[model samples]
Target: MKKILAALLIVVSQNVLAQTTQKPVLHGKNWVAITGKPLAATAGAMTFQKGGNAVDAACAMLAATCTMWDVLSWGGETQALIYHPGQKKVFGINALGVAPSGATVDYFKDNDMEYPPAFGPLAATTPGTFGGIITMLAEYGTLSLKDVLEPAMQMAQGYPIEAQTANQIESNKDKVKEWPYSKAVFLPHMGEEREAPHAGEIFVQEDLYNTLKKLVDTEQKALSEGKSRKEALQLAYDRFYTGDIAEEIVRSVKEQGGLFEMEDLANWQVKIEDPLHVNYKGIDVFKLREWTQGPALLQSLNILENFDLKKMGYNSANYINTIYQTMSLAFADRDFYYGDPDFGQASPMEGLLSKQYAKERAKLIQERNVEDIGPGDPYPFQGGTNPFKDLLEKRKDALSYFEPENPISGLEDPFLEEFLLGTTTVQAADAEGWVVSITPSGGWVPAVIAGETGIGLSQRMQSFVLNEKLNPFNVLEPGKRPRVTLTPSMALKDGRPFLSFAVQGGDTQDQNLLQFFLNVVEFDMTVQEAAEAANINSYQMQSSFGAHESKPGAISLSTQTPPWVRNELKKRGYKMDFQERTSGPINAIWFDWKHGTFWGGSSNHGEDYGIAW
Candidate 1:
């Protein structure tokens, strides 16, 4: 009997290890590249193979993903967190576009719109990805602009369109037809049953190719004239913002009835700033400041630090409830306080990120769910007074008319659908100790193409609010960036690189990231196990996209959750929804300093892929 029991124990242990992850963790000794598409990951690998560092490889991957329209384009925004080995510090890249002149709260309200339009040329801000890419290359990267852009330029000439993007175009053809320039490029098969390209069809963008070539040409000309590398790169940047390319962009946008003027493009510039960080359990996590929703994750981590999460047990009813409540607390502050730091009344970032504030917020979690969670007064922590006390009192009434709707028999929940609006993520790391995490988004499908440039205009304007009560700091204003959902994350332990990670789902970006971090740090899960792990999402926060709808008390769980766990959550007042997979296509790299290697993980949730060597 003892012999039989010993054999059974060994078998069970092996099975438990096997079931931990569906995808294999990529082990690398030199470098690793991961992103939203396989081809884009390959682009990063190609750059790495050519002796480019992680920053150069990351730039190549970003450019390729933009060219492929992997939920983004050249006209979209790019937000990144890069770790420099020599400095032993993480830097923030604020390449997000600013609202163009004339895009004020009064301008939107005068059109009888509660918020900016969700699509078309009128929805665009000044393009930022081009400027962002050049800035990173000129500052930290060793490669020339031509070397990093070669793969994307070739792809812009022609590449096979993936089914997901192709089908997205076909389904949104009606809206695409509304924009003449977009219709000309997207509807190659006009009048046919399928107006968009079929899967695997060679999708070509001649004008986009020429636009990229023009930047390369300008850089080459400057270099031939004995300009420094940085000077040559600056010349290319000037050509885009102030030269002929700017002229064409202004003319095309205006012709399409957009509000863009020459100054909008010419005056726009990318800013490199210090990123924010909070140390949790000796591990330092870094994210961009309030302009994006990055700080919310830090806030959540700070709150969770007060809990004995591992003792609560992973995915237990207790654990899920704790996480959901903590996220609600952090996100409530995010919706009300996070916005462009350069504009409007300054947000109390120091107060909001205060450890004392998190401890106070953590005290609010009770045995039952807090359905009416509202923003907390954080000003006192930083020695300031609350200026929007009246607004806080009237906040609940703002969305009182839209009661939480019950799930219909077979219909999709519109709130959930919009809540999960996703983009693509990029992560790259090299043996030289450089690491990059990025969440570039906007200019997704149904985007309006600027005439002759073949570049789709970003629809990120929809993220703004016209009412001060909803988010006073984020209210629409000319040249002010709207509060965005794109967030990339990184962690360091004992002053050494620990993890580089990011995800796609819009508002769920930080929610998923917070859990992914805990899975590895607290539970000892492998990077792949952490990436593919089931996660629960909270829908208590206001949507950042169309209509800005939210459903309080609603929560999504993995279908794998047991019946008893579901019943326990229901008893806690959560309206439970389930999915086979709740992990947003999370991509991560674990720096194994002990082993002197890298471990890469890409979630099986989507087309996200990674390559390592």
Candidate 2:
């Protein structure tokens, strides 16, 4: 009986790995969790110390986060990228929203709107993020839903508004002027704001609190009712999406000129995606696939590994120039072909990363002058193709067109606005492994609301192109997800989880990840140092495709780079945003092999985030 019981443990453990990540590594019984909030990170790590694994910790933190941060909430859809070390497989969770059955490009054109607004009920989609968290916890964690969720529930009922959160709300207060629901939640009172939202002021969300309770209570009842894991998950999902709440949401959207229906909500499914895998030198760096710009990080690494960066020197004139030019090529491909696998497909990893293509693309760089690059086929990009193109177009044509006007001429976008919009959480556990998740759907603005159902929807559609574009086998579909720049990543040495990371800053996310990947694998730098170093970011889109585009060679260098290195890139005709620091909040965890100690943290910058334990 003893032997049998032990064998059962092995089997269960094996299956857990199969469900969550691709690479698992160990360094003693230590654990780490990092996110935007210090309290939440500590809360998740507490679960780990209390015998919870990564999944349990993540579940706990995500719940707590909904109340603390509005970046990606239960109010909005969530997309998760997870890595399980024991299974040697990386898994991606697409918790993003789905368009209604009635959605079409012409729906907006008839209404005289160029692009969909990022707020209100019309922007609402089936929020599957919370449901997704529950699924992951049940399948890969040991804690009960009730046990893991209690902290967040309590926090949600009356979590104090944080200073950073309050500041963000204060900064973007104008965006909420249209929605009374949003103002009531964010602006509790006049001046004399509480010292801190978390410590003094009482931040209340009665609806969110009640909503969380229903999920926890329903999960408990399902368990008592003797339901299977999958059954219980469906119950909770239906409760929020297809059951009573969904009905209410649909009604509300109707009043607000929104595009949502029961069928569209029902059609939403969590897709299991192939992890973005790359062999950099001998080590493996796993990331979310081309659905995001994640593969570009690996592609950059593949080329950099061929050259000794330190030899060229860190942040050296030549080194920075080479990295910039290489990154531009990857970005050009990204803009031309990347989109949701259900929408358009842009293969970044194909023959594109080949010695032939790499050498060919690299030849485009003179290491002196910036050569302009739009979008081109290096080796016939064939990452993967979408299967729903023909059907999508038919569905789009169902709607009629309104008054047609000439496209906006002469740099139509007349706004001088700088944007910083991204959110993420990084964690690791002794028994479970490490996790790096960038749950970015929207930025810090009116796009989200305090107590609204779909708190500021993710501006993911912004990643889509206005022009009809063709990828290898994928094309842009109205309202479909754009090829994002979010990449939750892991560093593994021979199938062992070494480090886990995800950085903020749109296009900078991949660029930042590449630097850290090399730091850990090539330069033998600690995770902290790698993430702490300065960053050089390239453009994901044309920045703005008004009447002109900032094509390749139109790269921007952060001012933090020494003037000498900056001069080299400037002389090459690259644009620059000299900032005190133009990087992002890079969160990460590292498991040391020789010392048997695990140390991890979030970036020192990005004032909104922190690391605990």
Candidate 3:
């Protein structure tokens, strides 16, 4: 009996060890990539096999995500950071939708609401995902839109729902049942007494498949008319933004009693702009400008550059405190200063990113935590008055409202749940040194599917402030882009593309990326090891949601963190919260310039996938 028990113990130990081992980092000579879903990654790899470049692979992966992932939709918001080796330039594509022409402060006031509802036609904005993808393909991609979208169309026609997708569908079933079109796509057997689709069950979306097919058919028709590939792509894009599909979208929103018109769709266009960057040591980190929270990472890095992070030690109490405090100061400035630069007047981009300003702001980081420090006076350096100063003073009585309401709420206001739950990411790198990092989000469970179009409208309008009087981001103009949180990041080492990475968490997106970058750059860890490491999140600044709450001195530490660190943080007067994970799942690919190899890593915390070949 003793011999038999000992043999069984050995077997059990081996099984546990096998399960606990970390997955190896994906490596390849030709290419490597990581995306939010396995099928999406497979589509990207297939694109590469078909002689597609990194831009083409990334576009294909994102399109597949729209089909396979329940968290993203066909008509959503997408932002891309593309690095072209030939030009030695990084371009930013701001595909976030803007408020409708009919969206005014008076409209919400007339409806007896302070903010738009979390989920409904009222929350919808003009769709930008289709246009954004087309723009990328037109400029940089070698594959046609039809070729890239083929896999997504098939997946939409019918695919087995995975466990994660089934869970997401089930969680939103109550909202899905309210909209006939949504119910048809997500819970088809509603009246038949069946629950949401189960894992491994065949989930078909005929409407969505038809919707994608229409775009392909339009592109092909344009090609048949002797149009160039770029011209053909533009025609197809116009079909969605200004043709029959746009008409259908407008009709659906109006019929549903929402504020949207054909003019909004006709005037929509994706903005291609130069990316913003900051040099850390010798590497240059790139991100979108003020329209996103991307600049916050640069600001944080600027401040952190003053500290000896390596000397502080990785995951040490001193390192965590310093990073958290620095992030708090940067985010405070972001909440006040970051907005749609075109509509929000002049943003303090130059001053906020200036080394001198960062040095000045770094002084705010103390031995203990602080909260709601508010925006700084960057006008002296970048040329703009502090817009939030008056608003902050006006809401001084409600200052407590800025902190996150619940300690365990994960940066979401319970009162505004659906509006905050969104975002997913994909990244790819090819042999020619082209790299793309794209985040496609919005138009998920909280959004209503437009009638018969199979395209779900984005709830990005909720990111806009309802009170346009004092809020720079709340201007109710038709073409004004909302201050969005969808940020993708890229880095260059010695004037060449080094890394492409992104994540899904809304406000935590930049924070997650900043930590991952520090892990790899300062601690000298591999991409996989850096991504797998535990993270800390500070909730001491205003949220980027409707409520805009902040939790003073509140910090969350991942459970994987050492207990002693938690105690140290608590001793420092931080209102500590424990979480299984503190940030979104990261998908990243790193290029080794000297070795001519690609390395990829994906978060094991979720259903993310990484591949190289």
Best model number under lDDT: 1
TM-score, per-candidate, Cα-based: 0.96, 0.82, 0.93
TM-score of 3: 0.93
**Tens digits of per-residue lDDT for model 1 on 1-613?**
9999999999999987876578889999999999999999999999999999999999999999999989899999999999999999899999999898888888888889887998887789889999999999998899989999999999998999999999999999999999898888888999999999999999998999999999999999999999999999999999998999888888998898888888988888899999999999999999999999999999999999999999999999999999999999999999999999998688999999999999999999987888888899999999999999999887777752235455311115666666778889999999999999999988888898888888888988999888888888998888989899999999999999999999999999999999999999999998999999999888788989888877788888888999999999999998877888987799999999989999999989768999999
Q: Is candidate 1 or candidate 2 better by TM-score?
A: 1
Clashing pairs in 1: none
Ranked candidates (TM-score, high to low):
1, 3, 2
Model 2: worst 10 consecutive residues (lDDT sum): 399-408
- Compute the lDDT for candidate 3: 0.80
Task: Say what the RMSD of model 1 is.
Answer: 3.7
Q: Which candidate leads in TM-score?
A: 1
